[model samples]
Target: MSRRVFFVTCPKGVEYLLADEIQAFGLELVRHSPAGVWAEGDLAAGYRTCLWSRLANRVILHVAEVDAANENALYEGVLGVDWSSHIPGRGSFRVTFLGQNQAIRNTQFGAQRVKDGIVDSFRAAGAQRPSVAPKSPDVAVSARLHRNRLSLGIDLSGHSLHMRGYRTEKGIAPLKENLAAALLYRAGWPEIAAAGGDFVDPMCGSGTLLIEAAMMALDIAPGRRQDGFGFEKWLGHQPEIWLELKQEAERRAHEGKRARVPTFAGFDQDSRVIATAWKNIARAGLEGIVHVEVRPVESFTRGEKWSQRGLVLTNPPYGERLSERRELSTLYEALGETVKSAVPGWRMAVFTGAPEFGKSIGLRSFKQYKLFNGKLPAQLLLFEVDEANAMTPRDPDRSGEIRPRIANEERASMLRNRLKKNLKTLGQWARKQGIGCYRVYDADMPEYALAIDLYEGRVHVQEYAAPKTVDERAARERLAEALAVIPEVLGIDPADLICKQRQRQAGTQQYEKQSATGEFMTVHEYGCALRVNLKDYLDTGLFLDHRPVRYWIQTHAKGQRFLNLFCYTGAASVHAAVGGASRSLSLDMSKTYVNWARENLALNGADSGKHRVEQADCLAWLAEKPSPDQRYDLIFMDPPTFSNSARMQGVLDIQKDHATLIRQAMRRLTSDGLLIFSNNFRRFRLDETLQSEFSVEEVSKSTIDRDFQRNPKIHRCWHIRHLS
Candidate 1:
């Protein structure tokens, strides 16, 4: 039992956590590294680390550390090791080399050289030369060459500790076992479990955390369930000691499981994954102990058996695997709601790569840890689920509570300068074009996420919701600064500056009115008067982005019959009527917007009998078979990204139903008619079925103004017409 050093490999960013874990296990941690940690320990200490340390990816007993600056030095260094003591005579072995220097090059070449050195060492000795086994080998040798220094060790754990030998099936983007354990450890789950506390993972996919929690609760050694380790094939292996350690662990596991183990449960929205979780649970040998069921986060209310004021932990999926990343925004928020409503007063830890999504979860996380899930960087959002923290002015993300900066600080000054620069340039361009409404600042600085548009004398500031990675506090502060600075930069009164947080909206929610102030302000756009309300809604009366499209409609509206469908506030209809359209029909489901459109028309002096506004489901109106005389020469159809209003028949997925909606509009078109179809769904694809029946062309690029240049797909516009 000579004094020896060990190199324990762990995931990046958790080096300190691993160092603390090794120290807590009574092993003397010598130093820390980015990839792993260096520690002083004997054979038992190394063995114990493999048996107990959960944060470690692999426990490597330090065999040698040498300066292998060149390939010759590397060969000699590895050959110097007593290969006979570790690698058996001519037995199968795998060499895994990590990191690289200028001399060693790629991992494959380094691995080859290490293997050759091991074989040449054996040949130089009387022992049999070892053969290479890439997949599974008798012994696993870990090697590293960084800064011309080589550190080598025999991997005591056969597999990376994350394997745990229970997960036969995994859900999409499953959290690795060690990382899951690290999250739990960081959240102080072990202490909670030790004190007979309960465990819960509401969005537990495939039950990794629940199984890990159960193992921790029942004092089950992770290696106890594993098949084998690298030491099993090593010549210096002590079978009796290994057997004794495992047997002791097995005894503790049986006793703990048989006796009072903390109550734990897992829940998932998908029943199939719940079954997978159950199978995973059974494989982890916690079949009867941990309960799992199919339940959404919204239903994760307090339960009698499992809700004993313990940690409600989960790694809810974020934007990575999902095609529509925006959809995850609501999912994270629902989990937060579940915590606030169901598990109040309990401890909560939400591990998500996208932390901005956590904002929707409403409950503010007091502490956050930077951790990695494989290669993806993530955060473990820790919150003390106190009901008092759920809703209050103190809630960090609540609109009322702000950390405003008023242009004095350097960062604030930098933002103000950028805004001033944009305003001077785009502002002059707007005045030259006789454009009363235009963008001044479009997130020119990353810190400032506000989209500032100058509407006549008023300023409309829409703050883009911060991503999960940005600290909520940082987002709030930047938002506050933007809110404070926009009016001053625009030379507008602070009262005239309207601020709104723009979040990801789905279906009709995007078009859904934010308020009912019924307030209106008359604004001039390209000489045509329009009514815009800076308050009471996400959008002002005029969509500044679609200024060019409205102008295009107005220029082409003279003496032509116009039809506006799903027309919100009838800005386009008003523009067309002002352009002298012979007749126009404005159709909308919301009577409020129809009334608003009427006001916009009246403000422009185009509220005449020739222009009519109708409050009806636009989809139903389009469905009706119109008389031949009802055909229009010009149609303006801008449908919502999605809609399921009770007034409508079914959900309107713009991407899915665009063809039907377009064809229906074309059905009421004159023999040679033009339909301007547009939508704000960024992912919307125009249907090609009508390409044969109509001349379809996306005029989005030409119609997009300077204000919306950052996102060209802000709203896609197409000039479609009957081929005839």
Candidate 2:
């Protein structure tokens, strides 16, 4: 039947491209709107459009268009349409309404009226009326009420096309496959391929980008692998025409030149993600073109001439999953430097939901495109290699100009003056404690530009400010006035210090005020063990508060199997292993810290096999088999106070889940196993009545650190014993 069907749809920013795709299916565009183009075609054409259009969300095929001045007219006009031809004989049907007008002020009311009109039309035809189905429907009707006019249509696409059916493996915050493809198209990949440039994603999670790039480069249609589409079940289904289209699509795909072998590569630091990427690459049937590898971004090396005009596209992880904000920030900074230093003239695109966080990379963007990543508005920031605009050299220009040496002498003069005045007060305090550590004095008094940290044999200094604060400038001036005799503050070198302005989370509306340094600083204490300077680490770095429990392990660890849960840098494991434990198992979700724990074991030269580290979801792993040995004498569990990393199974609110977690740990304990449960949630109160399975004791006092004399409520530790 000849029908004036107006198709209602929205294209993803690329409207002209989608328009070209739609016209390819033999549909005629009669009119166009901002949201969609009005097209005239038969029900068959509508069905074909829905089944084949990869970019469209839902296809609404116009049933009837009528002018309705008011609500009653809208209902009656809709009822006049031939409902039997559009709807199924006896299956479910629904009316969904949208738009604004007086004829139907509320969408809910408009939908009800349309449903009633359809039901009335069916009833008048002497057929058992099909019931309204709220969820899925055999025949779904859409009603648009706008400007006192009513336009009704039938849904030809039952489900969104983004669900490509190949995404069996999902990591935290995975990008939609279609969306990833759209991003590649937007980033000028089509032209990049023509220019002989390659594509590389260092942080490729699941190989989505690499797969999409390969598919597009080889002219492979995304829908080639789908099992079914809504049009297959339609009354006007054209099997012959659909098969012809499919054959043509495959024919065109075969004629196209494939992407250069090894031109597309994806790397992920995680082994599991690399495996998932390989599976996805295989699923796309592009294993020959796309390569997946397990390697850190820092380890990525570009062969000679391979980097020229290359495209480095990466979606560096946001701090949301990895709470190591400080380290990630430094890592991003290193990445930017690597890009500038190593890959000169190469182009780059970084897709991130949080643009402000991108500042940590230290690279300025040239172009940014707003894109929707599944309701999350993200920016695909494009950066170019313009070396001329990069950061200036640290040293000022001294071109043919001779400045007074007294300025250097003046800096020395200032340092001496400051030391002389504060010598007995702060200096005596520092010297009495074996003055090897770098004495951090502001370089410029009013400028407040510098801070120096001393180590036993080496010094670590950092410039705190550039122009310098008034306090720093004044401090420097004061030093110049007093410590002139101190011989230029000898024995300190400038290279040992690190300096940068404080960073803040970018793109965040709330919590933008948070410090850039992060809430904690985790460091390796011995060779492989991690220690946090909690006081400096947003709170307390090293949990000196865990001393008593560590001491307990020293006594009970002999000839026992020790399991340190949520082992941060394996500090507790080090204590257990050092205490002569026969075997120790440390479980942490962070690979970074797991490696750190391995280092700790190597430092002590402990039996290598005796210390094992596993990176997995601690709760899920624990819920599985307990150690078959049932031989744990020291088991420590101290979870973070609170965190919301995407790596975690779910948000961990320690106060609410501590008791349950502790109870589970006790299950993994041997008959005489000691389950040490500790947390830094200061306001926490123990669940004194935990099922009577174990005896609990507060070991709060044992956590005290000898070095930390100021405000020692760093963390609270407890020991649990199961009495057989």
Candidate 3:
């Protein structure tokens, strides 16, 4: 039995674990690299490792090492190897080249050179040349070049050992099999399993963790279910040794199945993933050994039939958006409470990309391991669910209680008092007027510079960006205090409060998405139902300041053909259609807003052939000569203060281009039609020449509603008419 050098690859942080695993397989460790380890093992040892390794990605038999300073040297070095001794002359092979050098900048070219070398070697010996197969082939070759040295090897584990041959379907953002196995090992699952401790995943996605845990408990080889390996077709493969290892693995698996392994259960809120999980468990041949259910974390309770002490392992969502992150805090808190009340004496391990969220779990972590979920840095926080670290279940009646205290109680109290007074006045007035959305507070106190609006029952808070003189830390503390105070004073759930930072935006920044939650709610204003998304954008779909303007359009739109330019979400178009406008056309450059407008109209039962929403740049659309039928009796032009949107034909500065915009829009208006032009530029002034050319009246005062009286300059509006 000649000792052969083999290189094993695993995830980045699992190199040491893989080293230990290789040593446990009776293979001598030779060297360690970043994501791979070299070990000295014979053919049988290599075969056993491939059959048993739970954390390895690939097992490569190191055949040759050569200098590869240049492409020509790389080719010649590979050609020196005796091709006939390894792959057969008629066998097809695939080259998986990794790394780059000054001479071989492209990995494909490097692989091509390697392939050419082997083919030429076979031809030089007057033997049939081997063909290349990009997919599965008779033999798979591994070529790694680093620091002008290349290591060539034969890949023994086909298609990565992580496949495991069971998980054909996976949930969104599933953990790779090897990574899941490493997490189980780090959480001390083996010892717990040996003691007959049960295993559960409260937020199992496709049951990867549960399946992996069951396999570990039953001493089942990770690759036992695999169909084939890369070396099966190699000329030098020892079928007898491979057969012996496979049979031993099968025997161990068969015996371990009846060896009194502890219970393994999984639960997920998503029913789709739970179905996929059942399929995966069945495929892994652990249908009876592992159990899964479509249940949420909050519904998870310790099973009566399971052991008293077990491991509660789960991978909860690490939110990628601000709103999701905010919502996940409550989820983590609920998870903490559920685990403490359900499995008090068990151990809990949480794997998350956002470790800060782990703090919300409210349990003291006894151990923490820094790892990676693919390229994202992640951590495994292990907690003992005993009395010392357990959290008391939250009171259902006080679920909305603000948990964090305000840093400055006096300032927060002042803000709270002000909010109460405004709500008393504005809330009463909004109800009287049948308005479902209104601004309750607008930076009335300079220290707490926030604009808080109430839409239906949800609160949308926008913190105005603090001035340069304000300390960043102080501003943050004040914002936090405001957030803590708002929910308390408004008597609303903290989860219903969506907060955002308000800053001066340019070049369509205001329209850019802040999150992808896609949560939209309907609110009523002036007998019209409007759709608003409080989380996804800086400005909710319906601008609260534009309330009176939309109403004004509704009042005067009867029997008119309406045109809404820079239409945004088309709240005004909806208003016009609802107000009995004969026909309406709404134009905006954003397809998202166009679809939203259509939805808004559909929601209000106003989406008819008479009402149309088109996605077009307002400026470009205004410049085009309108057909006679395109002329409208009532036209509303509310352009952004400044826009350099890529979809637009050119830059739009309200101050510089207002006159041109008004003229172009006027060209599409009937001789007796009215153009209601508006903008939110605080320093805007009507073009003097336009006032002289047309009958223009500044309706800013009347357009500013009572909710916006504090900031009367929120927007400027005008009714432009042609002098007949």
Candidate 4:
């Protein structure tokens, strides 16, 4: 038996799992790579792996490796290969080429060249050219190029091995068969089944895990259930040997099915999906082996006395949107409760996309296996369900400890260190530039939930609203610790320090005065003077994060007309006016803030006639009146995440209304003008249509100051210009 190199592809992050599965077949020579594994084995070894290996996407047999720098080189190299021996003349084939080079940037083009090379090789050898059959090819060729080197192989498995033939019916976001098998392998399902233990998937969408686990326990060959494999149609395939393997597999499957199998059950809350799971199980010929039923998390109960200890596995929904987090938090907490109350001393493998949700489950895990569910980076948390992991002392003081916690103290120490480190660097930069207002801390410590800044000599502190689950007394103590640390940390007096808590503000709540202290501190940024109100507003008159953006406006404002939309306090307008802009107009819904913007302009000594402020809902203003006919050469538009104001006709959602806003804004821009659009919403996504409508370039990195280096996503800024 002569050995040959074989490439087995799997999902990204599952290379180690696939390598382990391949090595189990005694292939001794297995190397793992991104999204796949490489192995060296004989024909029988390859066949056996294709039949038994569960975590592989495709088993490709290496034919030749070529040096191809361009498409022509690629075609010549492919033509040099003897295709007649690999496939008969007129054999229908399809080529799957991956990667790109200087000359070939498209996979479709590379695939076409490879197909041409194969056909030319057959025709050049005086044989009839093979037909191309993308639908159902007789021979499937795989090619990939990296650094001018190409690796060509013939597919031994017809389609991806993840299509294990049992799942003709699938639910939304259903787990692929190979991924499900990998989860079971990581959870020690085979070992548990070997010990007469059972298996359960509490949230099984369509019983993918149940069928795969049952197959693994019964030693059933995946290829046996599959209709046809690519090798069966290959010219190099040995029919006699394949027949023997098939017979042997059938006999083993029949015997394995009759053996003592582990009790397996799948439960889903959706009754509709339960029927689909049963249909898929029967399709896989596991009629009485795997049971499925409709069961909610709240109704889950411990298994009967005979089957109590085994593996509980599930792939629960991980909320990908911010709005879904609150609801999904409850779901995860409920899942944790169900698993804890139903099965103790059992091993559980919970796959979730959000690692934070794992903490809500109230159970701690000993190990986490990195895996991928499609393109999303995911984790397989292996938890040992017991009293030691989930239960502990709940406040020895009985009334929830109100003093400084050791954990919070340690975190505060770390935050202090981080702040000092940042100040040593940013403070020097700020002083060198003659700037007196900047951020010293932007949530350096997650537990502290505060951002500290320097307003002239005053230390302004902001505390984020704590979740309802947090103890109020403890939150206050933590706040006290932060307050005590800030003044001492910056050598500022306590009397000059201002502390405020940030809550959800809608409409004019941000503008309404919190106090009657109309005291405004004059601050200097980039040689421009501004007034900041620390006592009476949720935000200081100036946003420290947009300092660079303001400076950018200053540099680009010379001899250009500038307009600022949804402008808060008109920092950008002031910068534009300071830069000698011909004229500037700033708009905002807050009349109080509009007055503040004018004060900022006056403090800078910019012309009152050239710089003006308007109080209006920006969306309504844009739609209600036509712009002064493309007058502005420079504009800045940064909207809120969500706002519902009594002054507006309807609510404004940045993501939903950005397209219309930008289109209307574009109508007001000069032919040679630029628009700087920015927002601080972390999850904001720009409208795709804007990509073609404007010459858009991301300017977030270029405009980020040193203070925001660690938190680049704090704001998203883009520079948009008219297409020439």
Candidate 1 scores a C-alpha RMSD against the true structure in Å of 9.8
- In model 4, how large is the Cα lDDT of residue 714? 73
Give the poorly placed runs of model 1, Cα more than 4 Å off. 23-26, 126-128, 306-308, 318-345, 354-368, 375-377, 385-390, 393-447, 451-499, 502-513, 516-724
lDDT values for all models? 0.79, 0.62, 0.85, 0.80
Q: Model 2, which residues run further than 4 Å from truth? A: 1-54, 65-78, 90-120, 128-138, 143-151, 170-173, 238-240, 257-262, 303-310, 321-323, 338-344, 386-389, 392-535, 538-625, 628-724
Worst ten in a row by lDDT for model 3: 502-511
Q: Best-fitting candidate, measured by TM-score? A: 1
Q: Please report the candidate that would top lDDT against the real structure.
A: 3
User: lDDT by residue for model 4 over 1-724, one digit each (tens)?
Assistant: 7888999999888788788788776455567778888899877777777788888889899999987888788889999999888886867999998988787889998899999999999878889998999988999999988779889998999799988787775223358888999999999998988888888888886888999999988989877888888888888888877787889889988999888878788887766567889988998899998999887776778757436669999988643223233345556677778888888878888898766566667788799887878877788998888879994312224453233234466767876787788779989988997778888887776667777889878988877656545786677777777776677778888888898753322223323655678898888888788888888776677888889999999988999899999898888898899898999989999788898899889888888788889898898787865646536899999887655445665556566567788888888888889999988766567877789989999888988888777677878899988999
Ten-residue region with minimum lDDT total, candidate 1: 318-327
True lDDT of residue 433, candidate 3: 88
How does each model score on TM-score? 0.64, 0.57, 0.62, 0.60
The residue pairs found clashing in candidate 3 are: none
**lDDT value, candidate 4, whole model:** 0.80
Specify the poorest-scoring 10-residue window by lDDT in model 4. 502-511
Q: lDDT of candidate 2 vs native?
A: 0.62
Q: Write the per-residue lDDT of candidate 2 for residues 632-715, one digit (tens) a residue.
A: 767888887554344765535466567768877878887766787877654567766764767888877666533322334546
Q: RMSDs, each prediction?
A: 9.8, 13.1, 16.6, 11.1
